[model samples]
Target: QDNAVPKQASGCVSCHSADGNPLVEGVPILSGQRSDYLEAALKAYREGRRTGGPADVMRFYTKELSDEDIKEISEWFAQN
Candidate 1:
């Protein structure tokens, strides 16, 4: 919520593609996951309740995102 405009839709879509890097070693797939689960995971990662590898990398990605961003991302995946 740093008052910055949300990143472009293309940015979000690029990495979350079905054929994207979701399963890359330690990366988590948001595609097809429940929204609640996605939110919880985001919260855990952002809060340090989760740790290690891409969890940490993903935590960094989630940390700076606004709650709205999380919700939008979750919804986007659910629809796809």
Candidate 2:
């Protein structure tokens, strides 16, 4: 498969930055984080498993992400 970094991640590049560092305050940096951790967190956010604080915003953003989207994003950020 292509695995060339999904286009869906482009939208996240702004706030999270291309390297997973957040440009805005209170946002967590995803760079170098554990892939499993990032994947679980993204799944939690998409499934409404986490709430309050940043989870609210993430929930909105991840609501439309498919399983593959979450996997690609988590893997990409982890690599950074």
Candidate 3:
């Protein structure tokens, strides 16, 4: 598997580190997560179906992500 970080996740590493260990206090770890769950959560944020806490931030970040981007990002983080 191509384990290089996804280009689409460039902005994500600031809060959620490349290794999936988020440095931010409230950010959740993404490493080793199920790709399907990550994709679903990202889609929920993008579609405004999820809310509360950092949902707004997540929504903003995910707003411009295409389905393919989400898939790639999800897979990237899942494998980390």
Question: Highest lDDT, which number?
Answer: 3
Off by over 4 Å in 1: 1-23
Give the TM-score comparing model 1 with the true structure, all chains together: 0.67
lDDT of 3 by residue, 8-34 (tens): 998888899888569899999988889
User: Whose TM-score is greatest here?
Assistant: 3
Greater-TM-score candidate between 1 and 3: 3
The TM-score between candidate 3 and the true structure equals: 0.91
Native RMSD of candidate 3 (Å): 1.6
Per-prediction CA RMSD (Å): 6.2, 3.2, 1.6
Arrange candidates by TM-score, descending: 3, 2, 1
Error at 37, model 1, angstroms: 0.6
Q: Give all TM-scores, in the order shown.
A: 0.67, 0.84, 0.91
Residue-by-residue lDDT tens digits, candidate 2, 11-67: 676688766558988777877889899889989999999999888988999999998
lDDT of 2 at 38: 87
lDDT at 79, model 3? 87
1-80 per-residue lDDT for model 1 (tens digits):
12222353234444554433553444556556787887777778778888886667667677777778777766666545
lDDT of 1: 0.61
Give the 10-residue window scoring lowest on summed lDDT in candidate 1.
1-10
